[model samples]
Target: MSVGDDIPDFPATGVETIAAAARWAGEHFATVPAVVDGDLRWTFREYIDRAESIAAGLVAIGVQNGDRVGIWAPNSADFAATVLGIQLAGAALVPLNTRFTVTETGDICARASVRAVFTVDGFLGRPYADEFAAHRQERPEILADGASIITFDGTGEDSIELLIARGTDEHRREVDARVASLRPEDTGIVLFTSGTTGRPKGIRLGHGQLLRAYWQWGGILGLEASDRVLLSNPFFHAFGLLVGLLAALVRGTTVYPLAVFNSADALRIIEAERITFYPAPPTVFQTMLQDPALESTDTSSLRIAVTGATSIPPSLIRAMHDVLGIERVFSPYGLTEATGVATLTRFGDSVETIAQTAGRPVPGVEVVILRPDESQADAGEIGEICVRGYNTLVSYLDDDTPLTDERGWMHTGDLGTFDEAGNLRVTGRLKDMFIVGGFNVYPAEVEAVLSSQPGVSAVAVVGIPDERLGEVGAAFIIPKTGASVDEAELVASAGERLANYKRPRRYFFVDAFPVNASGKVLKHELVASVTAAPAAG
Candidate 1:
């Protein structure tokens, strides 16, 4: 039987806002560990108390309902608290990626009209607060009137602890009143997608959409109260904030957030916390599997493994089960616009199915393939992937591009097809696809073919400008430790397996890939590298 048919239906929760979800979980799972970051720990009850105080503190600082609040820090207890507190204070949250430069962060904040920003003095030796202060000096009017910065781990009178201490009984009452007054359609978060063409676009999502979507995610994963989640994804991304933090909170699972993804540190945390479920991009697994500590680390506590964002080799799934003792491995498909997940492979799916396709649509979502003329494409036909569901983004903050048509179908710029069993195989992004001399070339297809070869740890394929062929494929490969790959052998194999037009003309062996905090390879950077090379054909 096909994999998607066996998914068991689950009920969605009535929790509307992040605040409500935190409160409900606190009441039901008060004694359960909520946030475990380094030496700091908080149970669900204690976490909610701090969130309530933060909400009151935001109210005391003149952050009113519908105001935009920015959180610019790495994953920590304070990040989670500020996220929930902002929700409780009836303000939309804007999470800036820590990897972004100060100029980039300033651009986003200005577009969102952020009033008060919550940040840290520094992380990983980078002075983030200092950078923001410098930006403020350059553009004094960048922030709104009376806007301020509240440091997370900084000394001064305006720190987060001071904000909490400033919360009065009256402000606390106002926090509850504001939460009660919040409607389900109120803006929850304004996430900036790494737009391919120009500046990032703020994707506004509502409280009900994010709450129910991730509650459904907990059910999809069959998360239990006994589950301890190890989260490596950055909270600034949808995968981290929605699936990692909110899902775990709503399901009564203990969550451990890693500020920086170090393979050795990840191993230590898994052993110490007895982490059962780990949801990350495939690069995290690739790195950990290659770590020298893998053989010595006590990884038997790992039970469930979820990976995506890149093509998953069938061997990787098998290795996760056999070597890491992780029995269940799943690959979900989504983007920033779809609330981080639209389709997910279930636990019991065949290894081949999980490796080849991103399983059926989530319970409440409708996924369809549309041709260039906007007509529905038949099964097995590649076209633009479109989605219509509760999890879809509310709107783009910059331009009303009419992302959704009259019928509410949001045409994702990704190209893919579905099998008869309703499993989706994402072929490539529309922008990532380029034409050879006279044929269409999809980079994902070529990369999938190369990923299975021996000694190839990770690979990325990009189309480079070619005078003869119009555009040709160039592959950048990272070899596994103690293993070396011959460029001639790889090109020969591609010649035998892939179509002539799809074969990569050149191969570059690299030690590592330039990935973002969320483990996503920065393809544009790779393309720039190719363009700068004098010998690139």
Candidate 2:
């Protein structure tokens, strides 16, 4: 039997576009609490209305169909509202990571040619709006001509309040017209990759692709109106925006947006709000389990837990069930190009399966293991994971490069194998990339930055095992001949150029690298050297 062939029936099957999904949610789940952020609360009816107003606001600000709009704020009700609003206004949503430096954010804005960006001030002691303004002033060509930044809490002309106030009856009509004209094939989102190929590529996903994949994902998780979900993941990621938010929206699940994750606070909210659905990385659960408040916190409300990592200890899964009282736990696999999800473990899966594998492919999606020569791998043979289905991305923005082959399979660059029962065990990655605290880091991207540093002749980065974080980048640097390199200066330079997560945790000054016959640096040897030498750095 084909994968995705046995998908169960789900609600809102006729909702094609995100605009229609919002309207459907309002009509069916009206009066149901949709979102809760601090003191702000809104029912589905009110939430949809507010989103429509934002749509009108965007139209009033000269946004047109197919235009790209950006949101550079933490997880909040306004961020969620703007997401649906952009879709309603017939614009593609480009979510910016809050942890990104000004240069990184500016590059995305320039690449996407975003017309306007919605942001907030005073998040994590950083003035996001002011920093973007400085970036624009320093590098005027880094953003599209006339691109504007609108802050959520400001009262200036560029404030979101004024933008919303500009919405009139005329703009509302335009927004409605745009919504009615939307098609499933139209682009709904443009999510950038983690620079796996040295430069981040914008992934274009269609309305139908997101709705189909995530609707099924939510259905598989048994999401419903009674479930209150705590969204701790940042909205900039695919898992947070599409899997956590969009899936919960369609299922009538009440969402609680947590901008930052604190173990004590998470436990407090879970108990107070009776949050039933919680999804996070393995590190989060580990941290919560270690928190002293765990003993006093009432966590019986947690029913479902979802997580994924390179390596998940089976003991952790048992602890989550035995300690936290979570009834269902799922481990899934996916990437940005695959619409955020391709497979998921079922409800009754064993603890070992949930921990050791990423489960089988989702309904309507096909996953296969391919050998180096593009042949199908045996059930137990590890090879590149390929995906083909409606969930595949429409294209990469501004690049004519074809991601899918003639057979319509997109190579995932992840090494994995399928069990006889269709369970997929992710073995390793074909690309020189690693996940640091659930965020992907590409060595080439890090090397690109380190190579530009003044005293660095060559640099190679590799993922080293970290107890707290799954993995972290370790940089091996070769200084220019007769030039002294200061580790402190390099650290400061990297801190300025890269996000905190992407920065190397350890720096090793090396004269030469272990190379192969073709002069390729052996990254595995570098990783092995760290294991052999305790204080190599």
Candidate 3:
């Protein structure tokens, strides 16, 4: 099927949704706690006020509609307020991943033509202002008024609190007053694509796209007021930013946010906050569930858990429910392009379905599976996934090339098939599928087999370039329960399901994989890790 073959009229309600949440909170329990940080709580009313003041800060600094501002901080209440302030001020937002090095962060800022950057002096441990000063010095254009350093905890320059404190009540009113002028079609933010293989492109998103995805996913997943959502994931990415923060706002609920991910701290907060909901990258949840305090932590209060970022193992989904005592763990499949939720396994699906399938498409969106032969896959046949809808991103930022091309469909470079029940099971990135001596080897398929075996808790399969075979497979395993797992036993497990040519010639049983904040194992890092071994040479 071609890209342009989309059905029209997928209605979406976006921009005004936030106003509804604000009005609801303002009228009902305005003084009730809405955001809980480290010993800090902000009531719904207070949150609105803080957001207003921050917007005033932006306005005073000359930010306006269409202006791009960089939010370079960890997950914090200030980070939430800063984003809201950007929204209220009618400015486009660019959230800088806090894990990015000074050089990497500077490159994105320069590329995006970022106007202002709001960051902390030191967070968790890293000193921001000093490192950024050097990085910015290398490429000096993106700085805002020496680029206006607005710190969260007074560690960098003037505290984010002070930026608000200096603004008058009238200034704050002006900020909120400007919110009335925004539209659903206006570019809310340029969500950058993760640069795993190429330069990161900004995924252009409008108000309608984000809001519709939130409500649509919220309906399927059920986000409610009584649910105390614990958000420890980074707020810079869409998973943490929109799905975690914005979703909570739309649902009119309490969100306990953390500046950085600390497993111990998150568990402590979950217990103390009586957190009822959590949506994190699978890797984060898996590691958190493995914590020694898992049994003792009052996680019994947790009702629903949502996992995303990368494809989560079915084993992980089932383990969380049975072992951690969570009622359900939903897997929402999406990218920044779809806002966040495109297809998801909703509540009440069998544990097998919840773990194996990515679930059906959201009501308005259309998905098609087309093979290289230009034909549709009858259920159970794998093909490239193409999607089109109102919530879909229009194009890559700064470049008008429609992300989906003339055909109206964005080709997701993933291989998967639909079941009789219509649940989509993603196999692996199409590009990652390697050919070893004419034998096709899907890394994810091998990884699944490896991780399912006894004593193997985590597995990542990668292709290593070889002279004669063209490319060969490699497997990295993280042993179960912190035990010392043997390499021979693991290799033999794979040899059962996989052909001799498809099996890995080399293996790595490590303490952990080099993962990003979102929990994706940097497969490229695995390449480096494997090649560095003395045996490989």
Candidate 4:
């Protein structure tokens, strides 16, 4: 049977809105541990109650049903609660990346017209509230009038605790009424793109779309109430919010939120919390595998591992099973525009398949590769990957330009090819592809070949200006711990495996490549760095 054939239907019905889904989970998994953070633990019922109280507080603070509320905090139980509370109050959520500058944050807040922002005072020694205050002072006209900044932990009047304390019986009734009035088509989230190529744009997604997509995602991962999930990805990103937290709520799984990712801390949490489901980017797993203490660490509880967002080596997949003892590993392909997911690998896929290809499209979603002329590409032919399904974004926030064409296909700017078995192998971004002399060289293809080279832990390939060929490939590599890379050996290996045009003309050994929150390498930054110092390579 195909991957889709054995998948079960969505577990519940009539739960169109996120508010309703939270209520349903609370009733079904009332006594189950919903969140575990430091010394705090809350059951599903208690978690939902807290979310409802937050909703009441939002209502009491003059937030309207159709307004937008921003959450600028890290991944914590409080962030999770605030997300549901925004939904319960019938307001769309706008999650701000914790790494964003004040200018970037202010731009998004103004564009999304956020009514209130929930932040923290000190996270990683940075005061988010103070930074936002500075932003408001610098660009006062950009923000909506009376936009409030409420800290998650503080004693002042603007603290989230104070806001929650203001929840009265009347406000609770108002929250309930708003929740009941919510529609599946109502906007649920406005997530900004990572802005790797250019300025970030807000992608708006509805409640029903997120609910349906992640329900199947959870089912495919075999998520169950007995599972303990370690959410290491940032909550601002779709992988953490929709796939990690929201899916856990639907599946009744216990969640342990990690605000920051330190391999040692991650291993300790897995051993301490008995974390069964762990999902993160390939970098996280690679770092953990390279940690000297990995051999002695107790990670026996880790069962399912999900990773993607960059080229993955099959050897890494095998090491996850042989070394980490993980029973299953999956790699998925998605972007901010497609609700953070489009294709996923099945449970029984081979390590080679899981590492090389992003697997088949999810149930109810149609994926096809179209050439530049708008014709469908044959199997094994590279083209643009387009998606059409219930999970497509509702719209670009405040932008009238339509993302989908007349046929309802959302043309993703990603390049990929499908095998005979319908698995997609994402080659690279459309904008990232460069022409060498006359041949088109895809960075991902070269990066994949170089990743198999010895001593190479991670690699990112970008095209640089070449006076002779117009553009040539340049690779920035991060060597394995205590391992040194020989440039002559890499060149010889590349000549054997890749064509002359595809081989990187220059290589730069670096400590690390700059990555966004989703663990995607910022290629533009790599190119800019190379441009500034032409002699470095």
lDDT (Cα, tens digit) per residue for candidate 3, span 159-183: 7766676677676666667666766
Query: On residues 100-192, what C-alpha lDDT tens digit does candidate 1 reach at each position?
Result: 888888888888989899999989889898899899889766588788789999889768999998899999999889888888778889988
Would you estimate the TM-scores of all the predictions? 0.95, 0.82, 0.91, 0.97
* lDDT score of residue 62 within candidate 2: 85
Clashing residue pairs in candidate 3 are 3-407, 3-408, 3-409, 4-407, 4-408, 144-147
* TM-score (C-alpha, index-matched) for candidate 2: 0.82
**What value does the lDDT take at residue 189 in candidate 1?**
90
> How does residue 322 of candidate 1 score in lDDT?
86
Q: Which residue segments of model 3 deviate by more than 4 Å?
A: 1-25, 144-146, 155-157, 309-313, 466-468, 499-501, 515-519, 528-534
lDDT of each: 0.85, 0.86, 0.74, 0.89
lDDT of 2 by residue, 106-208 (tens): 8989889898899987699999999998888998876667666888878898887888899999999999899889999899999988663357789998997
RMSD (CA, Å), candidate 1 to true, equals: 2.3
Better structure of 3 and 4 per lDDT: 4
RMSD each, Å: 2.3, 10.9, 4.0, 1.5
Q: Considering lDDT, which of the candidate structures 1 and 4 is the better prediction for this target?
A: 4
Q: How big is the positional error of residue 215 in model 1, measured in Å on the Cα after superposition? A: 0.7
Over all chains combined, what TM-score does candidate 3 have?
0.91
Candidate 4, residues 210-312, lDDT tens digits: the string is: 8888878888888899999999899999889988999999999999999999999998889888899999888789899999888888898899989985579
